[model samples]
Target: MLLVDFVLLSIIVGLLRKGSLKKIGEIPIRKLELIFLSLIIRYLPLFLKGSLKEYVVQYILVVSFISYGLLLYSLLSNWHLKPLRIVTLGVLLNFLAIIANGGKMPVSLLAVDFAGLGDFKQDLFNPLYPYHVAMMPKTRFKIFGDIFPLPKPYPNPKVFSLGDVLMGIGVFSLIQEAMLKKKSASDKISRRKLKRNL
Candidate 1:
């Protein structure tokens, strides 16, 4: 939800800067389907919790790693884009944290309480949850976990990780670049026409 907010904000900012919406389509993002496939693989286990729940749980880590690999590969395919490089770095940070913690993201209990989601504590601790685990003394790479709290009065408060922040910034920058680049090109053409008329 917070990420969605970031995207909306980016679009709003771009429009305010006199950027054209059509310019976003000009971005040379390659292999976009891999990102969707990665997401599908990551969440597929969540919906298969009836007949193959046990099997899914047992192999969830493998599934996660594979999904991350696909996502990374797709992101790397657009490595020439500076904003995407930052986004890829953020994803790499998350990948390292998950791998270090035995395939589950560690969530800080304190952060959950701060975010007014205390009710979710039990789910965080549940072994079958398959996505997040409660942060503890034994949790590895604690710095990379979801420890930052975004408390209420905000629209969609939630606990987020450092990597999430980086990704948001990267996305915002990407949109800005697309918007401004288009505007600058148009301005140059207009100036050339004015010089010709003069």
Candidate 2:
């Protein structure tokens, strides 16, 4: 949901600048396949049945977190892009926090209540949702947990983390930068074609 907010904010900013949706498509995310691989690994538990689901889900969660770290590392390894680098660092922080807390992203009960999901239970293996669990007194890396609440002030009420804030900034910067670069490149091409025609 944090990522969804990033996308929506980026789109609004892009529109404000008269940028086209195609500009966002031009963001050069590196090792994109690794991101997909991580998702596939994360969701792989859905295919399991019976008691095997719990054990396999736990194992896959570890593997999925590892895959996520790899994806961030891969993205950082390429382009030397500042925005992507920031996002990679943010993702690394989130990965570390999640792995340290048994591969589940810690959710603050207070934030949950603020989000109008106060009735949220301690269900970690809900088939409808995955990889999220309530933050308890024993949850490690408490600062990295979902402590931020976007309440009624915003249309969408959600809980987010500090790393999520960092990543949101990075996502907006990446999209805005891509839009400028795309427009600049298009202008140069148009200029070249015009000169040739003349």
Best by TM-score: 1
Per-residue lDDT value at 62 in model 1: 90
| lDDT (10s digit) by residue, model 1, range 1-198 | 456777899999999988877888889999999999999998887887665876876777898899999999999999999999988988888888887887788999999999998877998878777788899999999999999999889877789888888888888899889877844688899999999999
Taking all chains together, the TM-score of candidate 2 against the true structure is 0.83
Residue-level lDDT of model 2, residues 68-102, one tens digit each, is 77677676765567887777777877887778877
Worst 10-residue lDDT window for candidate 2 reads 121-130
Runs in model 1 lying further than 4 Å from the true structure:
183-198
| Candidate 2, residue 109: lDDT | 84
For candidate 1, give the lDDT: 0.87
Indicate the worst ten consecutive residues by lDDT in candidate 1.
Answer: 49-58
